[model samples]
Target: MALKPHRSPRRVNLISPADRIRPDAASVLLKMVEEPPPDLSFIMIAEDLDAILPTLRSRCVLLHARKPDPEAAASWLEAKGLKDFDEQLAEAGGNPLAVIRGHKIVPDEARALFLGLLKTGKRLDITKVAPGVGTGWKLDACADFFSRWGTDLIRVKSGLQPSYFVGETPELQSIAPGADLQRLFHWLDETESLKRASSVPLNNKLALEKILESYRSVFRS
Candidate 1:
């Protein structure tokens, strides 16, 4: 597809978070990047430029973007009807696009409940999970947070400091003893998969619940 011809207008290929491209996939694209078709243009976006492959980095011209002002970004999201994004905005490091990516799958109250459940470790009762815990709410954001939380659990269990979910050291410590190391890795993989497919969840609530089941299993082992 990279070598395909465009009749009239140029075809633009936009890849967000390009750093996540698998090594094999990046290898496949390396040739096309070196000699791209005249009709095609690829714009790769990444939050961390250093994570990009050296081969790709050497060939492409880098452009750094300024971080958006937190207050202004928050105002814009609120204006766009993404209310109570203070937590999301802060977590996103002032990236408005990241904050908006969730599309408001759930409200703040449900967010609180979901995190509360995670803090329960082995005691997380799926049966008592709130209705809005999944639904159509902030899916990308939810998956991101869920992924980070599981990672933190792994770190705590491995006797390391929390990398992403800071300020949760106490809760992570409480949950660490019950974590099965191998299961935590598996759970993290599933969470990352959920985040990738979060854009089009056929059954939004079910998707989140299924991942939550994996999370609950991490403690059981």
Candidate 2:
């Protein structure tokens, strides 16, 4: 019956069933649903609506959010031309909002460095790579790229999809058939976790070297 904002300041009044329900508390929540407030509208959001009471469902005016226009989504995919589009979408939990936020958060310099590394045949010195890959914003940028690259490689190995940032490197493709993509994924996970727990350590050079070395080893094998 009462309304309030989701966040602080309470500028908007929104109500949800999840906020008021409790175990062992005898309350007629159904009544509130049955007779909503006058001069106000009620909106119910659920991933699965089968659990709601039949009477409540019957009385409710169901309004479903329309799916994104296929042509618009296709235009977006065409713009990126990413081989791992599905993977990125998956990482963003299939939510278009999350995908946009994720892309927006990517650092421009970090992206440039990634392209540079790939072009150098994985031969770029750690000294040169450090400035581009160092821990900034709590090592977030580096960790995100690392994870995304690893995921792309894993997808390639599984024969499910191509990689977004990956290219047809003769050297890489020659050895990729014999490479251990799973091992690389595990190492990426370990490095990401370490970077997160280290409180932005001073040895970013060492971290960059380890990451590149591990990646080079994948193609070398």
Candidate 3:
């Protein structure tokens, strides 16, 4: 008789950002999910469902959560005593929970350092950025910032106001002239790829260095 591993009466395996799961990890998870114990349940959440593995996605019942009302969400955050979240709230496209998650996950200092580097353009020192947002989930945060900032650069170049970082219009205007629009667009794609990959275990400093290298390259003549 095989030895049985002890488990509770009910078990749930939760995977958020399901699309970021490594292929090998997904294969192992697939096995358990395929023939999971009756008491086991898997709940997966993803920002982009199509990016998740089809086999795994097919096994679960899908449900979509509606976006919360922005005004209500802002009120809730205010009631919780959170101020200075208006930027994150707008950045999240009015998704209140995302604003809260971002606030808790990243430090304010790291955010300031990143934006300062963005304004530095070709002079951006990678050493300064490495410590600010190079570890663990901070890497993901930095990647998200760069990806969105790249979009704002596009808006500025096109004579439209930025959606995020409306407060940084002067800085964006200063940097936009130096950046090639085509390269900025390409950098956006690269930043997104890096953000998705940041979830995996890797050298945090090296990853930030690589991403910031591409950021400098966008301004190449």
Candidate 4:
């Protein structure tokens, strides 16, 4: 058996995004937050409150940042000399900073690829689509894509409009009938866990394979 290395605890200021901190780290951080050294302080930021660990969230004073209005965001983008400002604003979900920083919140290609795979139904093959679910940030983006796709499917099944893929309602409708609701919702839960765990180093290939396999199971007809 290998011996476990000892770690020396040190005092330092922590400036981290609440969402990015993993569960294990959060537990350790919680103790610090509950009682920190006089010289140390913590500043945590997070866009999604639900993504933050509940224990950590409860300890901090919450500050809500309202998203900008779409029209205002578009105007800001235009003032910055960005063409197709409306499209960019929509793609960024009206987050002006995201548009300004050139972050593509909506992965169009990944969404299309996932929808196509969903359309395959029982014939879906995890190996063939594994490349699309690339490693690291790309894999995280794929999980985001699948989460939205699954939400849209659920919405369509409930006789509601597909929020993420409005134009692809017909395709959503096609797959909704065959989708295993329980499995799909379970997969959504798993993807949320995956997204929360994304900040840490992970086995990307194995993770993607498992996700794709779950996707395959969701469409068992």
The numbered model that scores best in TM-score is 3
- Residue 94 CA displacement from its true place in model 3, Å: 2.7
Per-residue accuracy of model 4 over 1-221 as CA lDDT, tens digit each: 12232553434454555676667878998898898765455678776678777988898887777887767777777888888655455445567787778777436665555667766765777776657653334655666766877788898988997756566678889778888889889989888877766666777767766776787788767
Colliding residue pairs in candidate 3: none
Models sorted by TM-score, best on top: 3, 4, 1, 2
CA shift of 175, model 3, Å: 2.0
Global fold similarity of model 1 (TM-score) = 0.59
Best prediction by lDDT: 3
**For residues 9-106, what per-residue lDDT tens digits would candidate 1 score against the true structure?**
78878888797676677887888899887878889998657557799989888888897676788778888988877656655655678677864334
Give the whole-model CA lDDT for all candidates, comma-separated.
0.74, 0.53, 0.78, 0.71
Which residue pairs clash in candidate 4?
A: none
What would the per-residue lDDT of candidate 2 be over residues 1-221, giving only the tens digit for each residue? 45554655434324364222222221354566566455445565543254355555676677766545534654576586534455455443344554655663256676667656744434545566766653453454465666665665666566644344434334334344655766777767765664454443447666666777666665442
TM-score of each: 0.59, 0.48, 0.75, 0.72
Model 2 segments beyond 4 Å from truth?
1-95, 98-105, 119-127, 131-138, 163-175, 198-200
Clashes of each: 5, 0, 0, 0
Clashing pairs in 1: 105-136, 105-137, 105-138, 106-137, 106-138
Q: Which candidate model has the greater TM-score, 1 or 3?
A: 3
Point out the higher-scoring one by lDDT: 3 or 4: 3
